[model samples]
Target: MKRLLVTGSNGLLGQKITDLLVQGQFPNFEYIASSRGADRFDAKAYHYLDLDITHHAQVLKAIETYSPDIIINTAAMANVDACEREPAKSYEVNVAAVANLIKICEDRNIHLIHLSTDFVFDGEEGPYEEDDRPNPVNIYGEHKMAAENLLQQAACPWSIVRTILVYGVLRDLSRSNIVLWAKNALENGQPIRVVNDQWRMPTLAEDLAKACLVVAERNATGIYHISGKDMFSICEIVEAVIEHYRLDASFICKEASEALNQDAKRPKRTGFILDKAYEKLDYVPHSFGEGLKLIDEQLAKLQSS
Candidate 1:
């Protein structure tokens, strides 16, 4: 709680967490955000440690150097299709890299706040709870689920937070994120073909960062389901974006098949059941409309910039 380290500091969630920490909004005692790259930030308040989790020596070196009480591991090979194609790399980074980090943290008795995904559960029984069985349908989910199991079996203190359909963020220079893709596609007048059948709770990145910090502050352990307020289809999100910008609604249409070189099989519904979060973490996510409005507001700012 006092001294902390957050991996994947350049990622969507990582960046938001850094922003919150810099603004003194995060409840952590003291924080140091780590990333694989030397991405510069104006966070004059907090410390930054640039280290790649994929490298064992670097991971151990950072842990030794920082000597943090808590390590939040958000670094992962999260690209679904890419993971499907490169299963070995996915296992290496998402599973093996995390195992290495956990081993290092265990040696020091440091708590780990590991982020997971809703994809771990196949769409069969959606609105999944923390105790529900995970039967991953894709390689990405498979790797993440394996990592979760590793954390659970380990002797160290760990908390695994599983989330879904994360979005929001504008100028993130990272490669594996979804928000800028939607904005860029829309701005270019490209027809956004979204899957109407797929359902999920798309949590905004800002909200997600706050929720994570809340869990960290309360020293909450075990699995927690975190996401947006309401369920929505891909097409629904596209329509919301179109309406937000007052663009041609026809530009956002539903595709019959969501499959297009999709190496990883996606679930029709990966939305989370967040009653535990509400009760335990006191998490209050924004409604679907509210979430969409926030995205549109951010998009408007991006347009003006």
Candidate 2:
């Protein structure tokens, strides 16, 4: 079996990828899950490595030790506001670390599957195609765009999978996603403000993991827009979350993006058009409602466990 290495193994996307490889009955590949610290999950079927991708030496050491056929880099400084607060830190994790991985993968002739975001666009015109021009409006987007540029120059095989508004749960991770955030706030009768102007495809983490697997399995190169099929405003997403869980919708306050007083600028309408992914990888995404149901099932399992 070919060995596949995953960075950021503790993250939402990384955890989903691990779950799929270990539990989804995909038998063709063995996995090595790496993160900044010790393994957080209870699963013991795969190898876990303490990898800090921000450090060049650590990245090199991990790659050398694993000798993976493919590397799926799900590690990123994803918080937009945090990225703005610390631009240097953002570049370190998002851009510089990616450069390190690209160089290593190129030298070793390993296929690199990198994750990107829809924020690369300014959000003026959305549902972007693969060939659309990128004009990032924030530091986070700028860093991710820079990483994409680095991938474009890589000598080894590379695939950049750009997704939006990913949501799901992990057993030990404390990270909060949109679906869980909405459900928790509404269930607790807490009023929350949601942006009505901004639009996204709201990808399910599992769907994105599957998309990454498709790219890996096919050794597909170039950028692919992998995201949910349903498009909705941030407000509509929360409304749907409330509807699905049978929670009161009156607690939701619909507001425009400008009124949110967020430190980072957000795109108004930046969803992906997945035509290229469909054609190249045969990638299909779950609808938002279907994603919520999956979240419910996963949450139930977590609770019972």
Candidate 3:
């Protein structure tokens, strides 16, 4: 049986990957889910290991112990503003840790599938292909780009899955995604200012997980843009959320990206063009509206439980 070790198992993408492996009925795969803390999932059906990817020793020990055929690294210091404020911590998690994993994976001949973001692009030219040159506007993107560079120099077989605006549900996790955040604010008659200047093809976390699995199953080498096919602005997405939940739309204040005064500089139109992923992995993604419905169903189940 092929063993797949997923890092950041407590995270949104990692949890989705775990859920699919345990519940999706795919055969011949034993999964090891590892995160920094305790298992976040209510069901204890899979092996859970505490792993901190930043520490080289801990990373090396975990890999040596599990010896997985493939390591899906979903762990990242993803908070844009926080990454700006603490560049050192960001570098440790995003760049140096990835280098450590690359070395280990190289020696062990384990295929590594690393998750990345669309923020690598500067937003001057977008709908990026796999080969697009990256010019990151923020510390987070720079670190991600650096990690990608590390993989390029490694002898180990690797696949980089670059995604954008990932959103999904999590069990027993207080983390809020764009979907939930919008729904909550609108439903409670709370006002929100959404940016209309930026554009993204928001990826559903489940779809991204499936894309990662597909990459592993095929042992696909090189980079792929695995994100939603539909492109829309943040305001449009919030408007869709309001429509889906039948929430009050009057409270939403549409604003430009400059008005937010965010610490990190956002790419203006950095959505991916998925022709390569479509042709290569035969991957398909949910529409923004479909994604909202899925989130609603998941939320209903969570509430009832």
Between prediction 1 and prediction 3, the one with superior lDDT is 3
What TM-score would every model get versus the actual structure?
Answer: 0.93, 0.97, 0.98
In model 2, which regions exceed 4 Å deviation?
none
Least accurate stretch of 10 residues (summed lDDT) in model 1?
170-179
Total clashing pairs in model 3 = 0
In candidate 3, what are the lDDT values of residues 1-305, reduced to their tens digit? 78999999889998888888879555667888998988886467778888899879988988889889999999999999999999999999999999999999999999999999999999888899989999999999999999999998889999999999999998765567898898887778889999999988899999998899989988999999999888888988888888877888899999988899999889899999899899999998998888988887888899999
Q: Encode model 2's per-residue lDDT on 126-228: one tens digit a residue.
A: 9899879999999999999999999999999999999998998888746798988888888899999998989898989999998898888888989999999
All-Cα superposition RMSD per candidate? 2.0, 1.1, 1.1
| Model 1 lDDT tens row, 122-175 | 888788889999999899999999999999987888999998978775454444
What overall lDDT, based on C-alpha atoms, would model 3 receive against the true structure?
0.90
Candidate 1 deviant stretches above 4 angstroms: 172-180, 299-305
Q: Considering only N, C-alpha and C atoms within 3 Å, which residue pairs clash in candidate 3?
A: none
